[model samples]
Target: MKSACATKYEQIEEPDMANIVDAVLEHEADDRPAIVGETRTTSYRDLVDLARRLTGGLRQRFRNDEDVCLVVSHPGLEESLALTLAGWSLGHRVAVLPPYLKSRELEYALEQCSPVVTVSDQTPDSAGSVAFRTLLDAPASDLGSSASEAWLETFTSGTTGHSKCVDRRVSRLSDDIEQLASAMGLSADDKVTAMTTALSTTSVLPALLAGSTVVTIPLQTARQFWKAISDTSITVISGTPYAYEFAGRKKPEPGQLKNVRMALTTSARLRPDTARRFMEDTGVSIRNIMCSSESGHIAYNSSTDEELLAASVGKTLPGVTVEVRDDAGKVLPVGQSGRICIKSPYTATGYRNDPDSSAAVFQGDWVVSTDVGYLDAQGFLYLTGRDDHKIHFGAAKLDPQELEDILLSHPAVDDVLVVGEAHVRLGQIPVAQVVTSRETEAAELLAYCREQISATKVPQRIEFVDKITKDFKGQPVRPKYVRFD
Candidate 1:
């Protein structure tokens, strides 16, 4: 399942205020389909006009030129993109939101952005919120006259903790789109399936802007996902490793995804088992692309080389540089794991309104990642775990990723999460919440772990679960594994 590696790099040009709106302007008169949704289809021509109308609607309704929050609740809907581009056309910073947020989570995001306007299929929590349909039906007006650059705000996956906003400008987004597509070797004719990330800068933008047809489908099961690929003749796919596991389990028909030439997995680590199994079933090796909300994409792994994909996300994508530095800002020598920092042409300005947090992560053109990994001799980035989520067992802090990788080797173990819980004597003790496909006991897993890792790193308690649920970003919800204590 080895694929083509990134062989070219290019300088990112700062596009004018077109943001996303300018993407389809070339086909304004041509009726070629640009976005294929589950419920509707938007031709390149209609996409432009609809977004223009929405732009007029935004101006007529809420004239604030700052930020607008778009709740992308409906899957495969054209209006979400239309409204985003619509907002950008007016020099408005558009913050795209996931639909799965609880009331409290949604409130936090809304409060931070304080968007002048909000649009969603559901009633948004913001003050000036309006129905998506209303915005879509508004009379078309000329694109906004403001020359201010539009911004894009995305949230961190928050798999191990809370989510934060990553505010980047549209000019940066344009360059990011080019680098990501080049890394994946995506082309204008490459039909792409965006099950969850139809609006994300990484997936849809590359194809949509390049005039490649983008297919959006409801992410219910692999059956439906594969069907969309077959129906639309999808040639490229981007999603999380969590979703790809299902596609492999369902097993596609022989040559069903023959049109799908490549795929990219992000958000969380792509387990070797998941990647190889999918490759075996579908002949499509999953390349684990390292991406961040603050920075669009940093690395690309095109090959399924066992040692490479298992340890490293990949080498740096085109026009991207990954540097490893120590706590005092000294560049660590190669192979020495430390802070994973990325430098590229396009990057988030910072986390919105959180100056302290923003200062820590967004340092000039570099996005200082909390991830801990090192570059191999050949320049591949190997991400071990987050710097913050170490399991502290009486001052002997352990990376959960290392421990989980050991538990994953078990025959019956399907998935595992290791976390530290407060204990009177140990200060904190390791607890393992494991997902299994067949019969297994905590005692058996404990014994298996003892054989692989040291006892201090082993889970003191093991809890069995049916499955590990993921958030909207397809990140596993790494809650404290709450105990009644």
Candidate 2:
């Protein structure tokens, strides 16, 4: 049986709820590239047709508007995109969970949300979970109800704590899409790359809606990531700071990334060295996007101003507001550092099934962020670090990024994490775990820090390590794996 959405497979102008279906149908007749995978390219016509075919399978099992479809994949670009298109087309709440979630963690998510159906590459150890191929070949039926408004539930990175499930309206997701598409100056000719699952939301979805071709590859390592990009005519790349730094570390041959014109990094602070190295090698400056899973795209360093590029995350996106507020919730003036609160039309409403946590962060219109930063006179945001990321020495608080920046400036320091460990007398002291390029000593680095920053913020203990632990996104896993007895 052909689903109602499939009936409009070739012609859906103004679709219901304005989700990915509309994007798919917008170029249903055009065969131009939609997704550029490692081995294959899926055109808009092909992607939409596949999505429409899958809609029939989805329509058979669940009641539209009432049931939820949980998509669990290693997050292959096409499979998740197809399932998401089908789910959103049918008005089901589609929650896309992270691929890295452990089995028990996935079970916890399943219990919390209780989706009526789960789609994944492998049939998860759950009752209603189905494999991608199974759903693709399942017989179509007309048991589905009429489509209604659909919402998407995506997760926060939870870098500092447990990941919260953010239930966001489709229209709001579209809001950021349009704004970001415009901000990036994306055109039909541009080819963007989705480096990781985290990028599918921020990069993949937006690129499709803007009608830009999206490139996908398995980012196993920095070398693998480079090999994938070397041949593709990828113009736009928006990924984690880890991706850029990791790629820049090997230092590609001159003009290796010549085709790339624009580079964007997520909320993770782009190391100045990494940015400078990428620019020198590729001739494209990496712009830092100050954003979170909770607030969507808040501010982007979209300017060419040297000071702005060096110090801030640029200015707020259109229709977005940023304020620096003190601990007591009073708004701080320009140049004063405090909590960075974001008020946006497209931010997630609240955490699903977690009211207390939602109430703490999602205060009415503005979502209070743990990030601490200040705005310049021109409204550019300069970040110090997260509130929890701060290391306390006696009563004095230490900004890890600030100290890391000072350490990184020294030629000897390669990559470093400034974590807090307890001292016998002092409650918490800053400890610098350094990864060096050349031979360096704790005393030499100590002298460098003493010259750059305040004596109190300098690392009390500097440990020479081969490597520091990093998250999947290439960000340092904080607290430094230091075991304190």
Candidate 3:
């Protein structure tokens, strides 16, 4: 899908922090709806008050430029937003930790970030951190701060071992807010609910910073999301591909999302079929955005149809430049696929404490990393696969996304994953792990692939599975075909 209109180029401007908070505050008076929960409706004014109190509390415990780790807190949007804004306003860095992290993972993140303050409802018993708080019932402080400091330290989403921090300059955040506000046509009257966790760079600040009243559903269950959208009168919805797939497969009640004018999916590859089903089920079609924490949102599929939106993640957002490159770092032709690099105002300065890794991924002004794709003649970006997972089979290389797209088109297949694995003979082959309708067989699926794609591009083998799993951020993880003989 093409962008709505080419954004006019303009010099980057830094937003006034006090003005941003005040704009959101002013919007609350005329635009916000009463957020309904188990107890009752919470006015926007009430939410602002809570944020002020919570920010005060967080400020008191963690001084300016200190690091804080936040765990998933339930059923409280005001408290969470307050803590996040407070942390940012006070020039403290915040790290969002997933709730399902095992003790080992938690320990690793804590040790890596070395946060002076840990703001979570789930404080581990053995934690000997500098300062810890439950974040509720804490007293507010009057600490002074400057806007030039770091606001948050977002860990890399794809990393599995010790987390890597991307400490972003707080001043760059407004660039994203402006992009979202323009791309999505956001207004203060829009009540936004996102399936994304607060820890993500895109989800938390952009909605609130765009002057929209933000509502959140605890991500434990999809049903909670349904409830929050209806109860909060959410007009805008944000989620990852997996979350949108769940909504499609589960066929959630339609009444809950009647008021939603737009639904957005980003972070991972979105299947075209899933987009089709989502639009058919809900009146709202999916808005797929291609983005990274390093460079906020680079592009968005603004078309309301499922196929175009799904075909490509879409054209570049305002103030961003995208290019495809080969191993030699030379630019590739429009149709040729290679490493996808982005240049944006919001791009990270460098990865924190990992200059070697940083230098490997970034050039003079662009973030050059694992993403692999190409832009079309029409300026649409099609993400084929991750550079790290590129599959070399005999004479030709295959992008997993290319194969997965073909597999997902099959009626019998519900979800599919393509991954590269070592093969003694071939060196590496594309293995497909598929979740399918009960009647579908591996042989039949393979036959279907033969008709759809070239034999070299077809999967070496297909495995029927009961479920396709996703990571916390809702991207497809391991393809279900784990070979253990």
Candidate 4:
């Protein structure tokens, strides 16, 4: 049986695929810097030429259009963009591995994707991986072909479980680039700090496709990130909540971040307190954008309304529909929280080579998310928590996020995670693991919680920890088991 979802991939046109590189070449501001790094800057003309040369290199090595090219490199660089462009230009499937993955994780990704060619700065222990320096000298040649069927595969953050390989059509991605450019109000004169990698479709591709200059900075401490933004005169910035929280630790001097017009955050839930502190420190509101590896830029809160920014993920973007559904897959009414599902042209068709997993999420034109959220009367979405992260209590199921958010509001708390622990009386009880900034007693926190939340929602135990585990994307790692001291 042919799935209706499968038909979405059959509508690609060659001209649509060609738009990737053409967007770079036909940009009106060709002389302006397209890629600026710590030491060197590449003009638009130079970047297009680099991608052309690399595309020729890719074509010489892999003959089959089915060949997948895996890219593993440090974030915030022109090389990553050039390599990705090269792969797309040759009509080959491309997958980008996170830079921070250990050798074992890299090996797992390699075993999963089995790319015939890999372009990286440092060689992975696996075979078929080539250093990026070797590709730079490859002879330049003009080539024209569209990998319309060859989609780009990106893995989920893997915070809750194993990462799923998501396949997005190149044609739809091109459409998203233009739509995003118009929605974000990006222009050629705008300079964005590419804090995320080329793998991040929302952050890197839209800015480049809009002909905006992107400044790439190496992953650095919070202080270094601020310095880079100030030095580069970065007009826009985007990253995870942790990145913004770390930057909020030290307030920028007056006018230090004057050049930065907009700050965007995604990949994890942005705490309201973090958002408020960031604005107070930098004098800029952090725009909380809702997106996933499968669905690109579903919603964004562009208004300066602090209350709205703190509570909702903002209104849905044009051409996208976000709705909440009950357990029966029936759409719920506004204000009724349930599974958050999205219907959009930009949503990925399915996971590559994983039918069981793909069928679990993709339904017709909708991607039914594992996340639990509700929509307001005004069409704003508010996320509650993940369905998988629920705790089974005596007669009730509790959302750990509800408790964690309350704990995080405390002045002494730096970070917190709530998980279910076995209880003889109740089926399970919630336990809180905390990373604190100052001296704080578990009793004190418990007492504070008693004053704020319901008795059933309060944590039975609170353990102080030095750090909380998180994935490469800065999302909290759900603990598999409760630790006993």
Pairs of residues clashing in candidate 1: none
- Backbone collisions counted per model: 0, 0, 3, 0
Error of 1 at 432 (Å): 12
> How do all models score by TM-score?
0.73, 0.73, 0.69, 0.75
* TM accuracy, model 2: 0.73
Q: 37-83, model 1: which lDDT tens digit per residue?
A: 77777888888788788877777776564445544444335777777
Candidate 2 lDDT tens digits, 1-485: 11122222224232233344576577878989888876788899877777776787776666654556455554566767767777766777777654655553466556555554677776753567766776667654322221445667765533111345666656667767767777888878888888754435567887888888998755577677766676787788877665775676576665557778888877456556666777777677888877777788898788886446756678998778998999899999988888899877777767777777777887767789888888988888888756666564543446677678778888888999988886532446888999999997899999887766546567998999999898999988885222212
Top-lDDT candidate index: 4
Q: State the local distance difference test value for candidate 4.
A: 0.72
When sorted by TM-score, best at the front, the candidate numbers are: 4, 2, 1, 3
Query: Candidates' lDDT values, in order?
Result: 0.68, 0.70, 0.62, 0.72
lDDT of 3 by residue, 1-485 (tens): 00111021114454444333444455455435434344454666665665567666665555554445443333344445555655655666656554444453455556555543455555542344322344445765432332456455666633212335665655666556656666788766777665534544455456565666656555455676677678777888877665675555455585888788888876666666677777777767887788766777789878654577757888898778998999898999999988888877766665666666666655666778677778988888887766555564542446677678778988888898888776533446888989887687788888877776556567988987887788999888854322211
Better of 1 and 4 by lDDT: 4
Please report how far candidate 4 places residue 40 from its true position, in Å.
Answer: 2.6
RMSD of each: 11.9, 12.5, 12.1, 10.9
Off by over 4 Å in 3: 1-42, 62-77, 122-146, 158-160, 196-201, 218-232, 250-257, 304-306, 389-485
- Which numbered prediction scores highest in TM-score against the true structure? 4
